[model samples]
Target: MSEPTQSSPTRPPTPSALSSRSDRQFEILILALASVIVLVFVLSIYLLGSESWPALQRFGLEFFTQRTWNPVEGVFGAVAMITGTLVTSLVALAISVPLAIASALFVAEYAPKWLANPVGYLIELLAAVPSVVYGLWALFVIAPVLSRWEQGFFQDPARLALYTSCKNLWDSGSTTLQCFFVPSTFDGRGLALAIIILTVMILPYTASVARDVIRLVPQEQREAMYALGATKWEVISRAILPYARAGIMGGVILALGRALGETLAVAMVIGDSQDVLKSLFGGASTMASVIANQFGDAQEALHRSSVVTLGLTLFFLSVIVNYVARLIIARLTPKGIQ
Candidate 1:
């Protein structure tokens, strides 16, 4: 009779329901945070554009095309700054990309765990170093060494002849072209130094990203390659790199973004010259560097607005670069990989 006593039917716990609820909460939290980031970006663009409208009205389209920048005369043009920004970033990429990829391959695929951990940590730590500190190092240490090296490297007769020919082909009205024909004074306080410093600064970021992307290649893929009698280099070149190309391109764009936006280090080494760089050895100014140098001293409303406009240009450039990178990544990624 006791055993026959009725008991309430037990129900199993609803694990799927709990998981679904948790996932929805997480998705909502993530969506809210992402919305905050977009809001901040839009707010920044609005504020900058509002401040820069006066300059845009006064200068019209010439603000972008003209090269002259005189605060006293209420005249300003951003061509030199824009050219410096583009050249420094491009040269930095050219110098750093190969080194970064090589370092990533070595650390991620070849190094032992003991070596990889410390090396990777050190690479990441380089990004944490202050830009001003890098500036100081460039000014004192690298500048002197580079100044010496430039005498032999840049002043060669063949190189100068090639440069002159290139300059002749450039438009006479081109501010960037005018920079190339300038007298060769190798002070090592201009584009060359900026490019080199930027290369060093951006290398860590690119390498770290590439290393992670490369490491993401599944072990099974590598094993399959190995079973096919693939050499280490073949596996890396064909399997790893092909699979990771999209992510690597993304890393390069991120590095370019950093280079484009760099202010303190570039300002310090670029000689703070508003002139377009005629030579890599000459002093130059970038949009970010010019803004940093002049923002505090800008007295006139137009002057302040011009600086703000430069900031806006940099923001737009970053957005465009990232967008292009995304497109490239999408193209490179296979349907299965994503």
Candidate 2:
């Protein structure tokens, strides 16, 4: 009484169904990668915060406000280091920005193809050189030159008198203009050296970015200006620079980030002093330089934690710099580019 039942055939998946499945998988993969990056960033912050917690609790606000940093006496403060870091980085920026921009302008607009390629390559090559090598070069080669220069400058009767007057003013509790002119003990390695090295180190970052952005200025824009009988300088100043300014600034900020985080080279050249920045040629320390120099010698737990707190401070400072850079770039970017 059993009749044979026909088996139903299975159908293959439709093209649209397969495509939808693939899209979901790709989305999930991208999301997972992004999530990993976010997780790592969060974990880094957590580690720094936890390690620095003891120092934070111990020092309260004085940690950032005071200038003394004696490990033996258990005294700790960061004002000098913070000020040195800012002064060196900003001064380096001031020195390098114009040179970088000029180099970029030449490579992008003035140079022939043959010259541009080689010049650009050389500029980029500077970035690939290790920080330690630069440190050594600065120490052995640049330091002696600077030391001689300082000696010669101070030998001048007029300059020496001016310096002595400033020193007297500083010793008399005047912290304003006099403090900056009063010279520290002569040494090849100091704030001026650090600024010079930092300028060399960050120059390529800005130059590369500026060159790229300059090149991206539309050919049509240049043509339009030329058709109106605009000179080459006029075209560049009026049409190209305005369009590329935002991107160029992004590069400068990125260079600042590099300058802020630089360690060994800065530490080696910066004289490792905890005193407030008194002169351009004076010994000083930065947050990164102090961390590099002192972390190994920090035998006490609080001392170690204080060093870690410096790291935390540098981290937040870098984060703030990057965030500000993003805001500026976003605000300045042209609508057409967006």
Candidate 3:
């Protein structure tokens, strides 16, 4: 029995086995790196919160609801700023989404061969232009144009007549109207102008992402729709868009995020006022714009804390918005569509 015990030799791992093992190791490494990145983000939030606690504790909940922002008196609240930020971003999205989608579809599926590349390039080029330059251009050129248009429209008897009915119901003499209404003849540098600037800045981002997603639609799916005697519009509306909607949504969310955080251009064009105006022609300040305008000059402890708190608010708000957007996209897009 002892003499019959013969052991089999151990075999070396094959090339494929080694390769797979190494690939898994690389994946694990990348995952660890990503975890570290998340940790850093958490740490940044912690620091900002800690720095902002002074003002948070001082102002309490009033910090969020109050509209006054006076640094000399050490009084601050971000309601108006938050409202301005949300309004401009929403308006920008409303204006840009249709234009961006149309431009993307044209470049990806309909433009002549000679025109497509140039159009795409121009979109990218618009994105490459500096924010400061856009601000300068808006200040010098677009602002005056907008002012003239606004004044001209409001000065028209027909346009003024249309608003006369609402003016009575809304009570133009009330404090509410005083806080919001801009007299229609007011010059540029308000919510509408900021929205327009943000739209221009964000257009390229959405268009480029949409075009890429449209290009990702499987050729076979499009062919099948065509074989079913579908028109070009039908194929795109029925097949291409449904397949690429998730990606398109992601792109729009990114553009919205950029619009929310835009600082210099918004600061330069938003008139740097803390008025909580509901009208597009009324001047208002955004969180980013206020921080850009006041951070350096904020020598008071409370003033500095308030600015930091604004930044912190924006950071957390962005995270929440992105999470909600992802959930919406996931719910709207069909299973296995992406």
Query: TM-score winner among the candidates?
Result: 2
Question: Each model's number of backbone clashes?
Answer: 2, 0, 0
Q: Model 1 scores what on Cα lDDT? A: 0.86
Ranking by lDDT: 2, 1, 3
For residues 263-323, what per-residue lDDT tens digits would candidate 3 score against the true structure?
A: 9999998887776765667578899998999899899989999999999998988887777
The lDDT of each candidate is 0.86, 0.88, 0.84
Better of 2 and 3 by lDDT: 2
- The residue pairs found clashing in candidate 3 are none
TM-score, cand. 1 vs. native: 0.78
Q: What TM-score goes with each of the models?
A: 0.78, 0.84, 0.77
> Which candidate leads in lDDT?
2
**Residue-pair clash count for candidate 2:** 0
Q: RMSD in angstroms, all models?
A: 6.9, 5.9, 7.2
Candidate 3 yields a Cα-based lDDT of 0.84
Which segments of candidate 2 are over 4 A away from where they belong?
A: 1-36, 161-176, 326-338
Query: Alpha carbon lDDT of residue 53, candidate 2?
Result: 95
lDDT by residue (tens digit), candidate 1, 1-338: 12335555784344676878988999999999999999999999999999999999999999999989989999999998999999999999989999999999989999999999998888888899999999999999988887787666647887777557656644464445544644345666888889899999999978987997888888888999999999999999988999888889888988888899999998999888776666767778999999999999999999999999999999999899878767765665554555
